[model samples]
Target: MRFDQQFLEDIRNRVSLSDVVGRRVTWDRRKSQPGKGDFWACCPFHSEKSPSFHVDERRNRYKCFGCGESGDHFKFLMETEGLSFPEAVEELASSAGISLPAPDPQAAFKAAKRNSLTDICEMAVRYFQQVLQSPAGRSAQEYVQRRGLSAETLSEFQFGFAPPGRDNLKTALLAKDVTEAELVEVGLLIKPEDGRPSYDRFRNRLMIPIHDERGRAVAFGGRTMDPDGQPKYLNSPETPIFHKGTMLFNVHRARKPAFDAGQAIVVEGYMDAIALSQVGIKGTVASLGTAFTEDQILRLWKFSDEPVICFDGDVAGISAAHRAVDRILPALTSGKSFQFAFLPDGQDPDDVINAGGVSAMYAEIERALPLSEVVWQRETSQARIDTPERKAALEKAVEDLVGTIKDERIQKRYRMDLRLKLSNLFYEESRRNRGPAQKGGGGGGWRNNKQGGDEDRASTARMEAPDTPAYGVERSFCTMCLMFPELFERHFERISQLTYSNELHSMFMTALVRIATDLAEGTVTQIYNKLDERFYKILQEAIVSSRPDEDSSKASTLQRWDTLTNRLQILKEDPPEDFVEHLFLNYADMLELRMLEMELEHETRAMEENLTEESWSRFQALKQDLTRRREDCLRDEQELAERGTKMKLNKAAMRG
Candidate 1:
């Protein structure tokens, strides 16, 4: 029995592929990232010493390098177990909590009719292509040429044209024995409400065929050739095979390249997709000119976990990105998310490419902003949090949006990220910017002021008031972000998510990120000047400036030197660039373990309050994660030390 594609999709989306695979194999903890839905285990079909079987739960598919065996959830069951295809489907459906549809004769009939309509669409596509090649499509050909689309591109994308007549396509299709109702049903011909004959739906436009995964022409997206066209671009009405929200243009063409590249590019227009494809950027697809949908986001995840959304840098494009962020937040999984690549003011991908070539377009991609940063920026861009109530409102606005995330792990991470940012923001707003104060005979740096008032106490509580055991690590990451923002751009998403234990350090981060994203260079001096006086002490602690008046005998002086020596080892002359990144990540790992410990404390309390199986499992998972991170931290530190020693020895050899 054939199943509905959507029904199968529903089952696939709801059922966890890793959970099924986990029952059969022990995941290699070192290689498997459960949070990312990516797992590695030895191939079950072929015996292997090392893990060669890989699973991408986001895509609900698995592949084994050992035996070249690959498939989705149902495929895995059919191959692993002795189950038939139908049996596997039923099992997965049952697990997904979906009721199987009763067998119906009409279902086959409807499916056949739907396919017939798709064939009719193919015929219409050929008809449009024929007219474009002939003398009648001169204007459309001119438009194509002017857009810099080559003949190869035109043929590859099946670029076509419709003449300026309502009945032109209808008459041609009807002559081939296509029924008027069938033509109207497939969205090729529009049926007039009045007592008039059906006419063509697309006219005087450059027609681009929209295909499905099977490479069948299911719909048409038309760009108007007329200069004063009202809508500018028109698409087919929702037909049996064409649903705008779930369909992306060039999916059949882009999927392989996107999967191969391990990334995908989402553009706002098909013309942009075609242009990029022409320029060798094959992993690009265009969204239907509709509001971004959750279904579309999920579908994109099949191709790439963090697909880049390249929208125009104009007002409308920015608006679309914001709307996509709103639609994407709820559907964000642990590993699956989106990034935004905004072009120069009023520029799209095509414009950038035309002016500076493909490299310019890539430069835009390199600077794409993470979804979290986008949300953080949108909330804080025009925000004024001078008063406590305003700060609460700011927190509420961001928290309400983040709370919409369905995944518990991702939601918690977002919550921590927000608290860190807001801590910086709130502390800056409420801090009394005092000048250099006499603390321990001015030998020590800024002393911790005794914060009072309910608001101040609440701020401290939300920010995790006390310094963590990994305070040194937190300061290192914060310092790196401020001092070397460019070197760590690749790790910006992870660094930005780190919850800085110190409020002033968090504030420095918030400012640094804000400036960096605004197309300005992020410098410690810029942040220092822009921030309140409280950040001065934090900055001094991070970069390690000379304080001649400091007494060496003092504990605070000793503490400052200790922090500088232990964490900021880069100061011991030049290290390998890669080593610096690894050191940065090492610091990140320690801080993550610190945050996990805090989570462990909370989960322990909740488990005590309610001794349920799920709570117990969650608590254990946290404990396991904390343990694993500690191991990773140690491993990283050893590697950094070895590499650092090697670098120092090499430098000494050069000097000799």
Candidate 2:
């Protein structure tokens, strides 16, 4: 008796393969892929050491490399328990809490039709595989080889080729009693609207058979070998057995590997997925040349909570990622969501692998943005929010996007985070627009003036504002940016606009800009290699200047960066919400003050030389400006010292 398709699907979803298979198999954790829902063991049919059998819980399929047997739970039960197909179904249904309907005539017919379609798909796959080895497939063979695919990898994936001859596949399938109508129905042959004869849909292309979760071929993805090919890649047209939007390319193959690594990566195309797999980064799948649908995203979550959506790092690629995020946001659950990976500009997985190998590609993967960060960046990156009206619009846009989230707790949290981000942005902007004195510059009062010569007073003035020690202040800021390159991502433009006070400051700032640009493009090594020895010495000085006792060789980048952040946090009373910008403004103030002091020194010299009216006027103006600037600088220093002392006392009280 045959069960309904819906009933079978229910059972499949309810009962996990690992739960059922684990009851019978002795699972070896060491043999299994870490976190990939893989249960590895010796083949149950024939006992042997060193497990070659793998049961992938994510896909609900099991395969035995030793015995050449593979299938879903139903097939496994029938073979292992020596039960009939109906008995196996009944057993699984009972365990899965599914009630099967009594067999009907229509059910039997539908089941038979489904079996025939499955058979046809398998037959076509075999035929294509055979043709791949034939003399006519030399170009196809070369294509795979040129892509660095070994013979083993080719056979493992069942790679194939279709010849240029229009009637080749049609004639071969028809000879095997696969009717022309069946070929058309399966999307192997194209039927014409005009009076022209039907011909092959995929000609002179590399054929990759796409399999269902049960490891049965359902459709094909074909790639053209021709350089001038119109559509570089093509997939089987939507047929009875295959739904394009619902399916992930190479998902069947990637499921176990993805589960093992605790990561599932979705690439832009089939070749990108394959290229990653070849380099030991397994469990990578590709979208079928379409924006990821809700179903596809959910399907990916079965293997991992945060599947990385890796696309090219170009404008079009970024746009595709934003579109994917929009599609995925509504379906996001508490523990499940999508991460985005952008390959270097104009580079795909193959390009990255060619340039720097698997580790470099993995580093890029590590940089994949979280869903929240992606959302925040997408809404903010496109436009500037300088005015109150524009800022309100930005806030409303964020609210609308977050409104789409169905989870109330997640929605509330997202709203709070976004509000805080907006607050930070505007608060920093306000600080920037305010006058220099009010912008946290100087704190010392003019009432406590000391008598001294012009140069003596200038020297005394430098000692009063010790927080920004002139010799090391520029180096310290540059060090923080170098150690935490993410700082550069947000402040690169501001830093570029800064005027340095000395040659050392200028050179350090230039190197910082170069490194930031390279870091953004995922090409840091290239730029770092081109730097001169003097640059290294500058870097070393920056590191040592920040922490006099810090072992520059042993300090981790993150440790140094954290130290910088901590230093900034304690440097003021109620620190600016945006600390990076605060540091930048401080640097700008320092540069401006230095220029004013230089002018004062020049005027003093000119006054001593001539004592003319113009010199006297300029000298008075210069001295007045310098005195005001020195007081402002001193005030800032006192405020910072007070904040630092209060913080230290608070920490002491806490310890007490």
Candidate 3:
């Protein structure tokens, strides 16, 4: 009976590959490759010592390198378990919870036949598990204990033992009404090609039942307790329901936890996955023996937007991680990404736990780099950028890699960020080539005047400072004094006399004067500590907006503070080099005069409405104060104008 393509795909998706292969193969964690998501076990077919068999649960396929055997679940069953093609499909369909097509007689017959085979496999599992608890299974139990497996974990993973002796399983299952022919067909009993009588296939081995995604036992993985055992570990042959590549070790149990955590972690082996789970990091899985494939990534993304691929810190592990990164990029989509975590040298997840407990393993995982960071580091750090050509090539390499991102918005952002980094790198290089003259200095705008060689330093400083009695001038002075408190030493008395209309400005200026007076060698930190929290935030904002050119240089603490203060002071005042100090004084007086004017106007308005004696007296006093302040401000401005003209005349006479 032909099945619909959609139905077949649905069944395949429902039954995970790990489940099917796990039932047949005990994961030999020692043989697993780190970061590749490859699970390994001894070849179940024509096995000698050592494991050449790999199961890639993510790909839903199994392959034995030793025998060159590879296939999906259906192929495995047909070849190893003596099931026909129809029987294999029926077995999978049933396990996948897929109902066979209605009105199909052959489908029903095959389904029934497959159900019987599955029952035989289940009965075999029970027999093996029971034997492991018997006196004959003592060695297997000891081995499990030595490996540090808890009894609960052993039971949960269905640890068992096959007693030594040819007919052990045969005699046990046959008593349960299982036929010899059925046992032979399921590969539980061996029938030699030369026509020898069938006997038990596994003997004197610790057995682990591999369960499908549905937790149905379909195959067995056996580990020999004997030190001199020919094959240290063995797995059940590919049966109608098991394939290695399409599965991940422990994924059945880890999937929900991974989904909950918003991430899934891919480790190298089953033991690593299990150990992590034991430590409370439950969303861990091992790739069956192969490099991470696109299918595996897709499956991981179902559980998490970003799955961390953790590998050993060795050469092979790094290579595998990079390979996985490269593979994931082409298929990258919006909101989907991968992180790479490399374990320390000579350490696996198990070693990490043994050394520093589970937290150590978590520490390693926490250091995982996002996909873009890894790619950027890989490209830029490895490139030679001594020459212009090489630097250009490095930039091109970054752009080329970023261009692979299909999402236009993401691609555009990458381009922007990458370009900025490139620009900064080159800009720094140019500055280094130019050397010390690039550093900012000279009081007021004098340094820029000299460096720029535009107008004379004196003339530029005069041209730059503005004489306007502007609002916020007090804030400018206070911010400057806070930044470069040394400047406050000479002007402290004048600063103390200043009053601010803005409450926040008043508090900030007061705090600055107090801090500068208390600390002999005034430090920004000292002033910062004395400030109102909001004023401290204002100070930081002032610093950030102070000097753009001086920001890049690595300045000493005092120098940085001074530069910040000086830049802001220059921004507030437009005066010749000698007149900068006078300008600051004038700026403070103008602020005070403006406040007096505003107070006078308010008092006058109240007097006009109420005509009360108290209001009239207050209005009269305010008017008197405003008149005195305006007169004093005009006198100061006139004095500043005359002083500037005298300085210009002196400069001209010196030039002549």
Candidate 4:
């Protein structure tokens, strides 16, 4: 079912875009603008030099100039991570605590088919768990014992056993009134040409239930006890409920601990994960015996920035690590890092912890090699450093590594380090270029004409670009305003007088007008009541510098009032769009101020004489007219806002 726009807007309101994306990308608060509370960061969707990615917290929208990507939270997830419509909806719903409505009649058939299949798989998991305790499960139990796994660990991992007979699961499922077609749909039973339905998967094997992050059993991986078994391992076929590429073994159980500890340990096999957990290393998970995928790495990063990869100290393990590094390098950022921990020869985490203690295993993990060094060593070993070919290869590798680093400061530092290393290597090559025969009498220094020429060209090319300040002047001004609102108040009149076409300037003027109207209404609370939540938050930050105390002096109050009045004057000089409504609101605000002043004057006049009937009648008529005008202005403002909403809808439709 498609979500309603209002419902989606509600979800956006609940979920902070900055908080959601900031976990993946490092974001720096941009200078605060008057009406806009926005942040900037390098776009994760594309590579760029300057941060052109803008996040509008108030509007709940994000736009990237480099990639031309713009969207709300759900669309961002779909585009950024390549998730399907329903998958994105499911994820956002789970995050936002929203429950999607059931599918319509058209979708009911497909939904029912999926539900039936999922029920079968869940039933299968339960059947296997129960069978593991039966007489038929003795061999499976013995296999677990041989592997040094305890009953508690087996239960925690949800290890199960399928009986040897082909019809065993079928018979059990049939006894529960489950149909043949339903079992076939779940990949448990296969349909033969003879029109008979029979089990074709997992016979006489130990079943390991594969769970999603929600702890739901979606599929299984079965291992055979018989050495002569046709297949060593059998995995569940793809169904609506499971996708192997997206699933990480034991993640359902490991996520909480990993998040709590601020790191996750990724292993190669399910056994390695189980072994580590049994020995008190609970934050471990394994890919489903496949290559490390970008999607899997993103999922891992969602829980923590640092994930330690533990591989067996073997040729296959080393090869896997190299592949992982190549796949994951482009996804890394400055704040995010990875490490590798290689076990001893012919050993795994299970063996290490069993032979030694958990502390000993922890020490090995603590000494894990950083991801950068691992990448460098692997690249360097593939070629000879003394040759020109090797030097070129090194330069390319360094460039690749530096390019992948998202943070500008970190990338620059890495580039400098790489240049130094290359320079040293080149110096050694230059020394070797000169023959040893001329060294004793008069040393012939090696001249690298090609290298010197290339360096000169590179330096000349670099001089073409002008240096720009990291933070622009406008941004600096906005940040200063946010940090010290009182200072902003002091210079408010000057700020209001300035005019500009930029978004920052427009937003600031909007905020200043709103603040002026609020101050004229007497109390800050009255001003907030008239404004939307988004504008209110901006005003709160713009005005409240330090807390007001009961002992605040009259002079301090007058100074604050004067500062605010000046800021309002400057903002009014060059008003933003909707200046007409702002003027109307300001007029009504003046009426309220006048009424207060007149009421005080009338109180003082009461001592001179009882007010005459004519004077009282005139006073009441004036008050009524003022009230009527104020209400008329309020009605006009609401009508204008409604028109603006309609205009936005029309614009969206036209674009679509």
- Listed in order, each prediction's TM-score against the native is 0.62, 0.57, 0.46, 0.53
Minimal lDDT window, size 10, model 4: 439-448
lDDT per residue for candidate 4 within 3-118, as digits (tens), equals 77887777788788877767656665554242565878877654444588888998888888866778878776654443556767788777889887777887888777766776
CA lDDT of each prediction against the hidden true structure: 0.73, 0.69, 0.65, 0.63
Model 3 regions lying over 4 Å from their true place: 1-121, 162-207, 218-240, 380-656
Please tell me which predicted candidate would have the highest TM-score against the true structure.
Answer: 1
**Which lDDT tens digits does candidate 1 get at residues 1-656?**
77888988998899999987776689999999999989999876544557999999888999998668799888776545434577778999999889988768898688688789999999999999999999999999888888899989999999889889879998898899999999888898888799787788898988999998658899999988889986898999998899999888998798767755657999999999999999989999999999988877876776676899999877788888889999999998755789888777888788899998887787678667778777876777677665657766787787789889998767756764555456555544434433223211111111112222222322222222336555556666766654444455657787667776766667767765664454223322233346555544444343232112112344232433324443454444445344666777787787777789889999999888888999999998988888888888898888777767777787577444
Q: Against the true structure, candidate 1 has what lDDT?
A: 0.73
Clashes of each: 0, 13, 30, 6
Give the top-scoring candidate (lDDT).
Answer: 1
lDDT ranking from best candidate downward = 1, 2, 3, 4
Provide the RMSD of all predictions against the true structure, rounded to 1 decimal. Answer: 14.8, 20.9, 24.9, 22.4
The TM-score, computed over Cα atoms with residue i paired to residue i, of candidate 4 is 0.53
For candidate 1, the TM-score is 0.62
State the weakest 10-residue window (summed lDDT) of model 2. 440-449
Per-residue lDDT of 84 in model 2: 50
